[model samples]
Target chain A: MMAVRSTFGRTGNHPDILAGLVFIVVGALGLWAGRDLRVGAAAMMGPGYLPLIISSLIVFIGLIVTIMGLVRDNERLDVIRLRPLLIILVAVAGFAYAAESLGFILAAIWLIGVGSMADRETRLREVAASIVVLTTFGILVFIVGLGVQMKLGPF
Target chain B: MEFLDSLILGFSTAATPTNLLFCLMGALLGTLIGVLPGIGPTATLAILLPITFFLPPLAALIMLAGIFYGAQYGGSTTAILVNLPGEASSVVTAIDGYQMAKQGRAGAALAVAALGSFFAGTVSTLGLAIAGPALATLALSFGPAEYFSLTIFGLLCATVLASGSVIKAIAMICIGLLLGMVGTDVNSGSERLTFGATELFDGVEFVVIAVGLFGIAEIIVNLETPELRGLIAAKISRLWPTRDDFRRAWPAVLRGTGLGTFLGILPGGGATLSAFSAYTLEKKVSRDPRRFGKGAIEGVAGPEAANNAGAQSSFIPLLTLGIPSNAVMAMLLGAMTIHGITPGPAVIQNQPELFWGLVASMWIGNAMLLVINLPLIGLWVRLLTVPYRLLYPAILLFCCVGVYSVSNRAFDVALAVGFGFLGYLFRKAKCEPGPLLLGFVLGPLLETNLRRALLISQGDPSVFIQRPISLALLVAALGLLVLMVVPAVRKTREEAFVDEES
Candidate 1:
């Protein structure tokens, strides 16, 4: 069973070490560029000076991360689960496309039906029931009640 | 007498049926969204922000303010009942609220929160009603440098708000500042950091970044869970605080109102600091300090109260001085600008009804929230259980339509999509979406103001120091910067800092 706590850990990767390494390299480049970019102002403050200062601050912060990552911090490797994620992405894309095509009610019905079906155990009949119930209520509330505009179809 | 006249006028405007309805809708919607985790008010406000384009400025401000604190109230419910915080300020609430729930005292916890928040809001709003005109005068005396320094002050306090780690928070703040630097330079009319795209000229849209980060990114993250939202099935009880709960909560509410009201006027660190400070103060004053992380009612009462109070107070800087304290306020200011209502000391004098009406409506909106939320808790809980897969497509559709409706630009919708993916990347890279949203909202204002101020000063830097208000703000910002590097402040949360390494 995937616990709620564990479910959130996939937000990022092998914790500090790898993240630190990336920040370290990026900061180093920023620092190098800042050193070159720091031209002294003659008439007014050089435009690059403020940014150079900011860039150097980034470098120092990155260096701190680099050192911290080296000295024995336990970081876990997180793996992404792709299947459901892909399905969600596709469902969202489909909803975007069909939203104007099928009209809000029909489009919403199909979107809810198909999106919920991403779970293997979800039955077509159950999804259909949910879709019919929700979309009908949505049309009543949003279109009829609230006067929200929805283009149902191209025709 | 003049103030009185203005107050009466404002009440007239606020009393309009359309404005009242908007206020009620804002509060009701705020409570609904606030109770649900993963839907922060920033995104919701951004998505709805365009509605103000067609509304009078007072109504727009009234509604946005309702949503802000209303969300604060709503988040407390989830914190108490579900052990999940819908927004950052509620993190402190969850510390004791969840404990209260586990111990079968969630009813008392929520009741205490509601009552305390109500008291705090009332007291602080009165505070605003009294002090706002004076502050508006002080703000009227301000020059460009003063306003500029105030903006710097808002940015500087991100240090105090550096949630987990000071170092990482600083890094993020700097990154936010850099991101704010994107789009065109108002001074030169030269584009910066757009990679030369025409869309780059306007800079990033708040709707795009906010929706991408908070809405779409939340959906993507939720997709990984493969379960519905609100996994916990907390049992709720009566909606009244016991005498003992009231006795314990009253002092906390008072302290929270004071702290929140004061901090809220400071510009940047208002609501966030008020919540954290209230939590700490409660723990310090608690008869049993250890009960803090457990289900202590004071913990829930104080922070919730302070958070709401702080939210109410934050508007002072924006309304009086025309200097926004945070991203949401910046958006409100933008809404005002879109309506051609320039907020300043003059606003109160010229449009007394708009100002006073808004103040009166805050009182009204808070009352509405307490009434709507308490009995309707079960309704929100039911809404929370709506499975993510089934619910998300609807949200996505609304988001697209909402984006398109405001801009009527297909490019805006497309931009939203790109930002959505980037939002996911930022999440995976350990960045908080809040500051990024802040950057996008404040960028145009910061750039425009900086240029205008400089143009007035003829490119002189000393103008910031010469102006008293600006000087004070600069001093505050300087103080914050120094404290960020202080060992005492930095040492206490080394673990929190380490977590921000990414």
Candidate 2:
């Protein structure tokens, strides 16, 4: 495992390689997902015509990009700090689930409270104050003023 | 006489109390975000887009247009005072504007930028008023083949002109086209790529993709980097430029305005590209280029005018031809779709008020920006001191609420989370998300036109080449592709984007 990791790190452009792999996977998935749909001629295109064409083009581009990545000058990927990445997503995901069931107050709190932790410099007092202030502001502006159709509480 | 009558109708419609108030709100909000770094006009517009659904169509457009040009005005404020460009379009403004500030001419730089921008805004708005009907008249004659060819030209030009690796941008556009095909096919009524999710039958909401890619992804990226804050460099002793400064800046402003108006009408050309190009032009044309980085008034004046003109004129393509030039125009197109307005040649003939009202509001918004930016510079400077830690949480709340409010579906918000993660991946891969958006908005239109054209031609592909307009557009797209392959033009393209990368 260690030898494999070192070899991967020493290889050509990591970002391009990753990007190419992603494109190939997504294109293949698109082709697989649309296998059931029909593809008529250009005059009368079936549901899968454009999707299949686009998927094949994507895969073709991905192949070229991957080849270029292998032959081009070496460039390392940027340092991936997963802490903020994961925390922000989790905060947003939590808000999505809680918004309808738990109501705006809890959802807004979950969003701001957890989302604030993504930053290393976040102070507890600052987070607490922001949650209170922003929640009230969101309620007034989004719900009351703009009529965004969100319930204020679980009731 | 007809043009004058239309202008009068526009002024009457835009000068209503409600439209005027929304215009002021947009300009004020625009300047606020423009003064603060880290947030961009695209993300702000995305966040605010859902809220506009509650508004009347003309009022909403008026406000959004205000925010777009108002940002250009406010960005130069921070670029001059603190040596930090609050928006990408103001990067060149900071080079000499900051030097002027350090030389105790901050007030002069600020005044010239605001006045020059106001002038450019007026000219571009007039250009819009004059060019709108003529373009619409020409567009009325287009058939399906012409539409398909135009979309192809627009997409190709967008990829070529956008600052990034062309192949990567093209790949991103393909991904966007695939995503746009996910919902039920209108022709056959069968889902293409829903992955077994039923909520996606109606298709992915534009707001969800926008807020996810621009808003949520932006916040995450901002968190990864440490913040840099610059202190205000000098005191404002004077608020007006001297006679000599005016003499030097007027010609540059005139040149910048002309260039910006023309460039902004092109696919993927807007404030940032226009500003960079204007700066290059000024440097090339100057007798003594050494004075550029050393507090030349023309340096501050030229790009400032160009960016404002570019920001305003970019609306022309969307309004007349129903084709968006960039990401922000894509958002506007999305907004128009939500309002049940199909933006095409018919818009001017059928709903004359909407087009003219928006044009009038842009000029009014520019005048408001001058008043908001000049005397209130100190207030905006103070706003720059607000830290990202305190700011991002509010923005995050807006993102969550904004996504949720779109159709009031938890599923959409959840989908946005997925796009947010994908956006993070794309950023790591050095792929721009802007072209993806442009492709997504145009995909359904492209597909519909292609089918119609082929159906008429009985599967014969020669119809595309047979139509004069369609053939010309395809030839232009092919020419652009060939230019990219040439080593000299490729080198120049790479050099043009170097400032953006840095």
Candidate 3:
């Protein structure tokens, strides 16, 4: 069903192709993972029954989508921008790791400082102000007011 | 007589000073966040949901409800002033609203949007009071078969209506259903997808997924587009709509309210679809269709009213059938569960005060929004001038602290980061997260009920078709699938989303 198979060498890649491939792979993985689970009868469905049905459907849908991409005119895939993507993800992961060890205020300040670097122009003064205000607000609203259990300082 | 008595009881419960304060607080926070670009109602609701855990359930629910409709009202403010749709539902509003701003009618457009939203909010609150209990009564008759069928219809509609390739949307839903099954199987006591991790026992937290997909992914996307956003520099000519503008707006508001109220009650339909459909209807009804997008007062008035009304009435399915029509409603459902309150047909009977109080507070909250939005227009416009560089960092920090505080688990935060990455990938692939969220919420319910229905029929697959209601729902789902696959209808759906995308 590769309608565009003749033109494949000429046309650039389309996002729909990649998306379809992802779905098919994910569906196949899900089916394989649940291979051992019993499907059970209609009157008594096992845990695998719905999963099996859904994964198969997912694969079917994925194939249809892949065909649609082949037959229909599609938008070309945009180059992935890794700079901001990495900065934002790594910054958040850093917070997840640091928030517990360094306490709320330090973790938050560290998060802001690193996250601010993702932007083209970084303003230190604004980042500093945001840190002070957000920390006070977080402490006031979350810690003291809501009584969410978090350490105030590493001290 | 019974309705009036219940109304009186509701007023007494909601009119208390504390609830009024929480309502005001929610409205204020909702407007503030709604005015800010990049943070939509879904993100704001998810970020604020954990905080509701500490408050009394009634007050917590009242505040959350206030935030929802309040955000709808405030979303139009940014759309009109800066040509930025602060929320997805307001995307249609930005079309004509920004044109009005360029024509030096910004004040008129903003005023009309606010007035139309307040009117729609009032009418829909009335609708909730009148129709909510009746729907609950209707839902009381639903068996496991009916529930399974209803969820099937909801998931299918959600997949179809989502703004992307229908196949991709269905795939997302299937993936969501799979992700939702990660925890232990309630009936069999075996984990479905969990790979023997202790954290997998309870399944993944809804908050973790919500924050990651909406909050974190949004920040990542916004980071890539670092262009300076300029505010519309049009002078404030008049602070209110002219007489002629009022004449054009009132009828549109009425039509919008009717459209929104009707669609909002449907399982998969809500504010975003209502706004789009309302704009399309307004264009169809207009004698001069060319004026529809170029600063037509009806364009601003209709979609704003429709969005707010749809937002309010979306609660019908949530409170009555315990089915969330959208992501924000799902978060609210999660909040209610945390408070040990199961929202369903019995909720009205078992928690009358909580039910009626939420209803009463909605009306009060609408009044508060009218007061807060009009006078604070200038302040919000100034908020648009704030640099995104500073603002996004604060948003990310709050997201981190919020997710961590959910269970004080670092593991959850890590999990949230992972979802955020996946969310970004989905966005790149043009797959929508909305159907995924809806499917995830409805997954367990669908599974549990399908099993139960089969159990009752001794595993006969025909059990779903034998019952009238179940059969009707399944037929509707099938019909929707057929409609979605039809070439003409698929083209129209794609065109609608494409118009909004540009």
lDDT winner among the candidates? Answer: 2
Model 1: CAPRI class: incorrect
Candidates sorted on DockQ, descending = 2, 3, 1
Full-model lDDT, candidate 3: 0.84
Per-residue lDDT over B1-502 for candidate 2, one digit per residue giving the tens place of the 0 to 100 score? 9999999989999999999999999999899888888998999999999989999999999988788888888889999999989899999999999999999999999999999999999999999999999999999999999999999999999899889888888988998888899889999999879988999998889999999999999999888878989988989999999999999999999989998999999999989899999999999999999999999999999999999999989999999999998999999998999899988889999999999999999999999998999998889899988999999999999899988888998999999998998888888888889998998999999999999999999999999999999999999999999999999999998888787764
lDDT by residue for model 3 (A1-155), tens: 10122234334336677678778888898898788788887888888888899999888888877777766674665556677788888888887777677777777777787788887787788778878888788889878887777787776
Model 1 segments more than 4 A misplaced: A1-79, A83-155, B51-54, B98-106, B165-196, B199-201, B226-239, B268-272, B290-295, B337-346, B452-463, B466-468, B493-502
Computed on alpha carbons, the lDDT of every model, listed in order, comes to 0.68, 0.91, 0.84
Measured with C-alpha atoms, the lDDT of residue A27 in candidate 2 is: 86
Worst 10 residues of 3 chain A by lDDT: A1-10
True contacts kept of each: 0.15, 0.80, 0.78
Cα-based TM-score, every candidate? 0.81, 0.98, 0.94
Q: What TM-score between 0 and 1 does chain B of candidate 2 receive? A: 0.99
Model 3 bad stretches (over 4 Å): A1-13, A152-155
Q: Over the full model, what C-alpha lDDT does candidate 1 score relative to the true structure? A: 0.68
Candidate 1 backbone collisions, by pair: A103-A152, B9-B353, B10-B353, B10-B357
TM-score of chain B of each: 0.88, 0.99, 0.97
Query: Model 1, range B1-502, lDDT digits (tens) per residue?
Result: 8767766776777878988998998998788778766567876776676556667777788888898889988888887777777777787888788888888788788878887888888888878888889988877776656766766677656445545444555565555555555566544455554555786577666556566556666676766654524444358866687788888888888899899998887756566668888888898888789777867788888888899999899888777866666666766775776677886788876877777888889988888888887777778767777555455655655565555545544456566666676566555545555554454445445545665677677777787788777888889788876876888866754533342232
Instruction: Give the alpha carbon lDDT tens digit for every residue of B1-502 in model 3.
Output: 9999889889999999989999999998888878887777888877777778888999999999888888887888888988877778898999899999999999899999999998998899899898999989989999999999988887787767757777788788888888888878999998776666788788888888889988899788877765547577486688789899999999999999999988888866788888999999999999898997799999999999998899999998899889888778888887898788988889988888888999999989999999899888888778877777777887887788788888887788889999999888788777888778888878888888888888988988798899999999999999999998789998999877776564
